[model samples]
Target: MSQGLPYDKITSAYAGTIVYPPKGTYGPRMQQDLQLVLLHTGELELTIDGSRHAVKPGQAVLLKPQHQEYFAFAETQESWHRWITLDLASLTDEEQDYLDKLPFSMPIPEALNTMTDMMLALQNDYLRQDELMRSLGYSAFQMFTARISLTKQQELHPSVVAALGYIRQHYMEDIALHDLAGAAGVSPEHLVRLFHVHHQMTPIRYLWQYRVLKATELLSQSGLSVGEIAARCGFKTAFHLSRLVKEQTGSTPSDIRKAAWGTAN
Candidate 1:
């Protein structure tokens, strides 16, 4: 039997590379694939599993599998990175544990600089049609995960978890900080502090991001009009939806539809 090409053997569930331009948002996007994002320049804000992180220069973000990762650049800075789509079967027990503990936004370590260089080089090779580049890329992911696996464990506070849960449930509706504080059984001031300490996002920004994420899914999976989608996602109007979508995804609903279906009727 002949061996399959590496790219060919890349299962639909497998990982691949994605490049983001200046002022780009990779998503209000979620994937089942394991992804390691290395920020080349610019700042990246990642909201994963209802927490927000701002990762700046010389830092990296790991997107955990099945977690919702929504990203937007802090400015018009060009942020570029490579992603490897990986299936659950490929991860070892240790790596799985590491991923479970993460969706981290932290500065890249000096020790991992060598690995980052190698991952970038492999991206170039893969672009140039080198089949061995896939192997190199996988190795780089491994090294990056191994580095994180060694970090000390941090305990999560009860209020933080409650706030995250409330966001996930009520993202499609209008909710206020006091509402979340009530759900978490804390005062509004205390809830705000918990959000800052654990998630780095205020409650309102998290709700906005969550709504945008839901709006993106509706845009992709349903045939709803922009106005309808805006209402469904708790936006005041289609124009508001259009503006926010453009600001976050660099495209309007009509634009996304046109790209997906070739034309918007």
Candidate 2:
């Protein structure tokens, strides 16, 4: 069966390596987004929806939305792992369906080396945030997903996809949830739930994050002043943009620009 996950957009992605503290435990709760965790050293014990899964080195776990999970380092040993968090709403229906079929945990002994390398690449590209690096990161994510999934194609809801396009096209405007819902031909309440399920955030939060991301790009690539960049990125003012940027990234606009230009501000 040439069942494969469809190629879907990656809205946002980041990867990190973590070492669990001795006797560390995480969450006896549910997650709102999709997560991929790859064990590199020691062992992790996961309880998913009441089922116990022992994740060994060279193994990975794919957790879907709303899945109740609890995790801890086994035998109080320090465990090293790499994890990626993705917005699943960007998936097409086919891709989401394929993802739904995969086992919660699987051994990828042969792919250990390749997977680790890809994770590192993704982390670097995300941090750099250049146009080329962003593109490469998206491609790397697709390849990583393909290697782990057994499906051939992924698809998103047509309306949701349409809404995404609309947001991308008009992100610089003062857009509202109702506007997006109208574009998708759904009620505002429905749109909120849809975003929550797929994007793991409300539509407004997504809009804010998108604006911030765009502003950062401008800060890095353009000679525009903070006010000019803020206007172009749809902030109410430079102050508004600066506040959000600092809140989200812990960096001021000047600092971001200075870093990009290799100058001290």
Best by TM-score: 2
Error of 2 at 213 (Å): 0.7
TM-score of each: 0.44, 0.46
Model 2: per-residue lDDT, tens digit, 1-265? 0123322343445566878877888899887666677888878889988888888888777777667899988676788888766554455567667667766666653433343454455454345343222333343343345344323213555566667778778989989888999999999898888776655567788778678868977987799999998888889999999998776554578866664564632
Predictions: Cα RMSD each: 18.9, 13.0
Report backbone clashes per prediction. Answer: 3, 19
Off by over 4 Å in 2: 1-154
Q: Residue 114 of model 1: what lDDT?
A: 47
Clashes of 1: 3
- Model 1: CA > 4 A from native: 1-155, 262-265
- In candidate 1, what are the lDDT values of residues 152-233, reduced to their tens digit? 2235577766776787787767788899899989999998888676545676776775676578668756898988999988
